[model samples]
Target: MIRALNLEDLGSWLLKANGMTSDIAEVAARREPVRRFCVRPGYRARLMAAGQPVLLWVSGDRRRVTPGIWAAGELTGPALVADGKLRVPLELRWLDDDRRVHRDTVRSDGRLADLEVLRQPQAANPSFVTAEQMAALRAYLPDGCGWTPALSPRG
Candidate 1:
């Protein structure tokens, strides 16, 4: 099992990433959980379930920081809190070698409505990812990698 990490801690990391301050970044959170998203250097944000290499954009716009906003596209994995800093559950996505006993299990939690699999060998991600999954993805972030509290600008 992996040690569960919180978005608050993540924000601290992101502050170091962008050369920002944790206290100020926490202020950027605006009393909400932080969020990190994977995006390409060009700014295209999305990650397929198969673990294909893609650009990642770690973001969080606490009121005390730049942009003071947060946004992104498909977030593949790593610990990203969705509702009020609650842990979102996530299961693995693997291709069946045809030697398995049962189909892949589905993840369901109260904070998130549901993240059902649209494809077998691949997964069609629906909503935001869980905090645990995001932490594991730090390896793929850009040079300024770290945590960033997310604040939605609009729908």
Candidate 2:
């Protein structure tokens, strides 16, 4: 399993550090360069698309981060997700693109629903990764309207 380098919170949802660590593992597992970048006030993907060190706005239950907010450091949490639903609490570690290390834990509310894996495209054309990598990337997702697994590069 992936280990935590660090973690943060926006509301109550705590994005897993090991998740990102697993990302690093995937990079190593793939044995190639991983295009890594922190988000601005948006999702990491958009931040990279627009520019580096962009502002990121995360929405969680525990941490209610106002829009256009900025922070710099690691964050961690013990959020509980019932049946692994996204409706659980989150604690977003407030940090910037300069920092690369962070972590969080996803706890289910003892509801063992079958874990669903999905896939999509990065842009609109064609390209995808596995549900594993997709889930890993989803953990870093910022708050937005079009931000869904259907809108991302999936396997």
Candidate 3:
């Protein structure tokens, strides 16, 4: 299950000394360049030691009137302070070009509205998404949308 996380909401979600830890164990279990990022140093070290791959979902800023998965990235190097805050190095693959997916589409589509993660107060932090939810999100993608999978090589 992919975890739906708030990228800008730090009040509810906490990050490690370096980066955020994975809420899902499967993410840590993967190998060969985990398709994820912003992991706690310990977890990141563990994955590095195990030679695993991590996948992370970055939520768009709701305050900025943006919502939905914005991008996914693979951790590359140790976390460092950039623009004043410690940040993990990542090669990000953007999921969407525009922030069109909103509460309307989410509620209008039976597949999207059925997602349990989104059912709660959107002001909360990162939440888990079942495989069915992930599939539904993918299936709902409009034709010719610029969105791409997290694994794809970013242009």
The top-ranked prediction according to TM-score is 3
Regions of candidate 3 where Cα sits further than 4 Å from its true position: 1-64, 73-91, 122-125, 141-155
Task: Report RMSD for candidate 2.
Answer: 17.7
| Tens-digit lDDT string for candidate 2 (19-113) | 22234333333544322222112232221121111122222232422222222111121112344431212222343432322212211311212
lDDT of prediction 3: 0.36
Best by lDDT: 3
Ranking by lDDT: 3, 1, 2
lDDT of each: 0.25, 0.24, 0.36
Candidate 1 lDDT, tens digit per residue, 56-123?
Answer: 11123424333211221222343344544422122212112231111121122222222111111122
- Each candidate structure's TM-score, on Cα atoms with residue i matched to residue i, is 0.20, 0.17, 0.38
User: Candidate 2's error at 120, in angstroms?
Assistant: 20
Candidate 3 lDDT over 1-155, as tens digits, reads 33444222111111121112322223222323333333333322222311112223333334533344433433465455565644555553344445334445666777657454355533222233434444455554444332222222111
Worst 10 residues of 2 by lDDT: 4-13
The clash count for each model shown is 19, 43, 8
Candidate 2: stretches off by over 4 Å = 1-95, 98-127, 151-155
Candidate 2 clash figure, as a count: 43
